[model samples]
Target: MTSSPLSPTETLASARRTLRTEISALQALDDRLDASFHSAVQKILSCQGKVVVTGIGKSGHIGRKIAATLASTGTPAFFMHGVEAIHGDLGMLTAQDVVMAISYSGAAQELMTVLSVCKRMAIPIIAITGHPGSELAANADIHLNVHVDHEACPLNLAPTASTTATMALGDAIAVACLEARGFQAEDFALSHPGGALGRRLLTHVRDVMRSGEALPVVRESTPIPQALQEMSRKGMGMTIVINETRAPVGIFTDGDLRRLISREGDIRQLTVADGMSHNPKHVSANALAVEAATLMDTNHLTQVVVVDDHGLLIGALHMHDLMAAKVI
Candidate 1:
């Protein structure tokens, strides 16, 4: 049988209707939140082993994403296909593990098979399902109801709003468990060392800063020509001016050099102290590279001096250092 195509107006109207339905479903899910949500979080937090997320078909797809999110956010988790569990994959489970079973109907035969094993092993089960009275939910230690009045699908047959609600609930549980465990950004960075956020959270000023001879430094009263040589040797386009005790008192940059030349300031008569900007921005050696980047941007600087607690210049870092380190 041939079907008629929708007009442009009809197509737009249908799309709007779907969005509205899903939004309404999410609002309903939000309103229905109560003690069970908290119970689910507490159960996962109390588990000593990994969270094993299991489901079949579309639910399985959502379960995999939920498991990934949980694992990435400090909760140890993995996705186990519900059917795979019954077919010898159940060996992955331990008494300490928590089973997060997903099923819109809460009556999947494959899930039912694993639920028994979970029970026998004394493993806690958190059920994410639309039907609270179904066998899976009835047997679960905590039931997270993801019920929706209707799916975003025009026929109301596809898992649309229901899956969205389920995924949102799963995220809520993961974040709650993360906070309860006192999971910090540095801890998260450890698991995601290759990502930009990992670099920002894990990298310190000392890790990326230029120290020793690589740091361009000049005594306070050094001649401008000598400081220029130091900057050229270090190739940082800048140099720190230090006092008698080796404490940074000022900074001179390539920009300052250009301005001095433009103003016809006598380069031969100038000292590093006369050419430098007093009390330049600096950061602690232990400060985050990202924080250093922020200070650089805020101060309109390309480089900043790294100092120790005693206010002695320990190192310096150019903005390029942070960019190369992927801290910015």
Candidate 2:
């Protein structure tokens, strides 16, 4: 029987099958992690200089990410082009540095050019490739085998699964090394200071919450109109209603004003406490913005009153402020 030309449905099915096969291949590869993997971790952990990652083509792209991940995770590393190394960039290599060469076939000519230079410098070469017995692997101090049995691409010729496996292996290496060195979240956040998670972990409420005279505050006995004036003057969505002790008792918002007017209530006759939402959500000055965000979300609030340990109104934080600060 002859094979028939695939219909559209069959073509899609074939593509899905390839991806499934490649995904399974990675799972199979995961089981192979053992003492050798641990040994590689030890080598990187003890390195005195930066781990220089290099490759050509698709492998080069993966190498760049590996270098960045390693660098950001406490391992000093950077990427150098294999071709550039021979064209005077070889001086970037030091005896103290470790060379990481990446290739799918372990036969990229540009990588081979730099591998010999690494050898001359007495630098330890770590290779990540699909071919363990290939020259690039055999020439290295340690070869991280990233072999994939199939490609996620329908043609079975693209770098899809191979790159995925390489990336996973790079992450595995970085994590193992990080754990061995007892790396902490604070350490990781320091390198990712521009991201939301970093801001949440580092930014204190005191750093961004409105304070000083700008804080929205009004006495409980103050008339609803006066409290509305305070809220408007402060530009905060709500004003903190407080007693003589200067401790917060309630809060009044634009939302509350709408509801009070809808009831045909007299704003001038009402007290600040009458229009306030008692038991309004509050945060401490030292609280993390991320915690504040969670509290605001859970309480269905757009703003939170910031108070000191004594429950005295200190400042206020709005949802927009959190968004601008990238805390959201």
Candidate 3:
């Protein structure tokens, strides 16, 4: 007797087999990484001018993304489409620059044409491809191989595995270069100051803090009623209860006043020190506003006093100040 086509279990087994093959293919490509990767990293770091990543089709799209990541991380970079290089755009290529050329097979006609022009210009070239023997790899100043044994697609035609390897390899090169140059978060922030992460990283407490007469401060012996008036006039929702030196002795807020009400204590007899919280949380003028935000968030507070190392109060900041500065 002949057996019928198997059940759902058999179909699932086929799918698992495909997934395992693709995952292994990606892992195999990763394990194959070697010295050529370091060579590529050196070429990028030694580059005096911008990194220009060029490729045709899908590789071109990935090239643009790689360039963006490099630029944002402190290595200057831009993308030149491979096909456009053969047109009038080859003029953008300069001898001072290093070129990163991407091709899966390493034989794309447009890439070959651009590589030839790069040779004539004496610009050093780095090649990324699956085939080591391809013409594109032969002319490289440094060569990086992104070989993978199989495609994730069942038909073995789509670019999933190859592109993944290429992208992974590009990221490896970028990070290696970033580490060599000691690229820092502040450096990244300068490249992206208009973005939220940039603002969060670059903005300092001095840039967003309220200083001078805007500071809500009262001496330690001041009457509670007058200190309440000072808090009201400052509009920061709190007062820096201070000493004779204008250093913060404590703090009083609407929170303190709310706790004041319904108590049998006499409002007229209460000294500012009686209602003040001693040694209130404060930040320095040079500190990051984001740090101030963290201080407020961690302490369940709405404001913080800004002081110098000597304990003299120099500034005050409220949570809304952070919101307005986009520090939150």
Candidate 4:
């Protein structure tokens, strides 16, 4: 049977109550944190093998997220279903590995079976449960209590606030380990290479800069009209002016041409050097593409030349290249 929906006022009140309850649970968990939390972090840090996080039901779902957070933040971890662990997945564990088992009641039978195997193998177990007195907590090398006074569920039977507390505690653990290991953003980007942060941190100017025939190049002596043709052919809106040694000396842009024409009223007498902006900004090919983007933004430039350490021009980077690589 469909129950009557809550009135708007009642619905807002209900949402507020849920949020307040979860916030209270998190506050309580924070207040209750003690030395055991430190021990858990140290154990995981000292572990030579991966952290195998296992649980059942809602705790299992939370465990999977916790495992992923830990993995992405520099810890090597993976989630193993409690039932699967008993039926052959336990082989994934090693003597050097650590087990992080979660259960609100701390009495999951599957977890108990896995705990037995961990005991025999002398592997350390870190337990997260709402009950510190339960067998899993009592037997674990370290116990983290996520106890809440009551769940946000109207019936107080659903996982609600307890699950929120569990997930928050898991995040706390991951962040602690991350800080302890001195994990940096570059390290995180390595793990998440397909993510936006990865693209920004890992992509270099050489990886995205136009090179070879795609690079718009012109000699300082090249006529302004011919330089404009090179810019159009490359579609970069600008052409790099190079000396005989192919070192970028200046850059001529569409804006520069328009300004020069407005001032000179030329009858096609000017060379690129006559109108080009001197000392064009350049970055080493090994510099990060994001760094090049920063340089462009700071200087109000549309393009920057890519060069070797010796300042020999290798390629050119237009803002469009950064956009195409999603590095901007």
Candidate 5:
């Protein structure tokens, strides 16, 4: 006889139970944070060289991610495979470096070997394992216990809850180290320069906006036809409607021009004030490009005026500028 497929209700209940078990495991992990965690963060923060993270199998995968997180969050770190470290990769270790070893059982031969080498080199060790009394934990300079009561796996043998707890603990360590170093958003953006998030965080409107002659600015008293001429000359698809003092009070876009021509049937009768949208959304030149994008999106506009704190139009940016800057 073949095993029957689980019913929808049974499958749903099983998934919910697994999730609940993992949640409880994470809560236990959270409750266990204490001086030991603080010491680990301090140790990582004091490291003169890069953080060397190593582990075997599933733990290795988590170690890789932890190393990446630490590296991106202000701590310099890299993952060295435990087994490979015993080979030629041992050269990656230095006396100034700190080793973070991960093993659920804490007795993996490869990890233990690397730990032994680190000990001989006088490198500091931070151990993450379920077994607090195992050789790896006992020998480590700082031991972080990642014990979980149950696995999310039905068989209770696979690393489910344990890995989740380990990852969360790793994130906590990274964040703590980040705070200790006073790492700022600009530093994070530097690390992620190739990603869209980096562009959004690092770029300001002033960096991408069109200023001076490239920006179309016209007085409210200017005729609609002249404003249209200014829009064409600047080729920004919009012109800033400014007051006598050169402060932006409105904007006239291609859309606004089309609507006016369609509704009035004669463009000669309209002035810049009549065709322009009053009190248009504006952004500061120093604001993050993402914030400018948000303002444009919130106002249903393809372009927005960039102003200084005094409400003087300093520059202008089109949605295309954000796309070109990779801040979209």
Candidate 6:
């Protein structure tokens, strides 16, 4: 039978109540953590093979997320369906592997079947359940309790607060393992190469800087008009003035050209060196593009030169290049 719709105030109140209940469940789980959690982390760290996370129903959904989080954060892990294990997918298990089985009630028959197979294969099991005394938890090598005092559901029948606690516990374990492994942002970026963090960490100056023929370069003795022409052709808003060894000695930008024009209206005889900003800012080709962006922003520069270890100009970077690469 359809129930009457809740008024706006009642709907908001119900949402707040649900959030409060889940928050309380997470708090209880946090307070209850003890040595077992440590043991679970040590087991995972010591495992020679991947972590196989398995579960059924709603727990399975949470298991998939936990497995993904673990995998992305330096702990090798993948999700397995508990039901499929007994139906011949148990071959995925190895003696070196650790199985993380999620069952809120700690009594799923499929998980029990997998548990027995794990025992026979000498595979370690880490069980996450709401009932610490339940059969699965009792038989497992390690047990993590996700017990909740109440469900967020009005009837207390659906997996609401219990699931939230279980997910939070899974995150806690993943984060603990991540810290133990010394997982850093660079490591995370490797696993998530298409993400924003990956772009920021993995993209180097050499990858984004315009090099070779694209670089707008002129000799220090080149006329100001010639330098401006090169800058316009390259569309970098600036030109690098190089010495005899092709080392950047100064930079001539459109802003400098405008200021020069404003200061000296008759600049037809002036060379690039006369108007260029000496000791131009430069970065190493191996530096991260994000670092270059920081340098540019800090100096209020529209362009910066890329140089090799010996201070020879290898390339140039414009603010627009960083914007195009999405590094800024």
lDDT for each residue of candidate 1 in 183-232, tens digit (9 for 90 to 100): 99888998898898788888999999999979898887898898999999
lDDT tens per residue, model 5, 53-96: 99989999999999999999999999999889888899998899
Model 2 per-residue lDDT tens digits across residues 63-111? 9999999999999999998878778888888899988899989998888
Candidate 3 ranges with C-alpha deviation above 4 Å: 1-21, 259-264, 297-300, 323-326
Whole-model Cα lDDT of every candidate shown, in order: 0.91, 0.87, 0.86, 0.95, 0.92, 0.93
- Rate residue 146 of model 6 by lDDT: 95
Summing lDDT over every window of 10 consecutive residues in candidate 6, give the lowest-scoring window.
Answer: 220-229
- Give per-model TM-scores: 0.88, 0.79, 0.85, 0.97, 0.77, 0.97
Using lDDT, give the best candidate's number.
4
Q: Pick the winner on TM-score between candidates 3 and 5.
A: 3
Clashing residue pairs in all predictions, respectively, total 0, 0, 0, 0, 0, 0
TM-score of 6: 0.97
Poorest 10 consecutive residues by lDDT, candidate 2: 264-273
Question: What lDDT is reached at residue 154 by model 6?
Answer: 87
What TM-score would you give candidate 1 relative to the actual structure?
0.88
lDDT of 1 at 196: 84
lDDT of 4 by residue, 1-328 (tens): 7899899999999999999999999999999999999999999999999999999999999999999999999999999999998889998999999999999999999999999999999999999999999999999999999999999998899999999999999999999999999999999999989999999999999899889999999998898778888989999999999898988999998899998999899729789988889999999999999999999999998899999988999999989899999997
Model 5, CA-based lDDT: 0.92
Candidate 4 ranges beyond 4 A from true positions: none
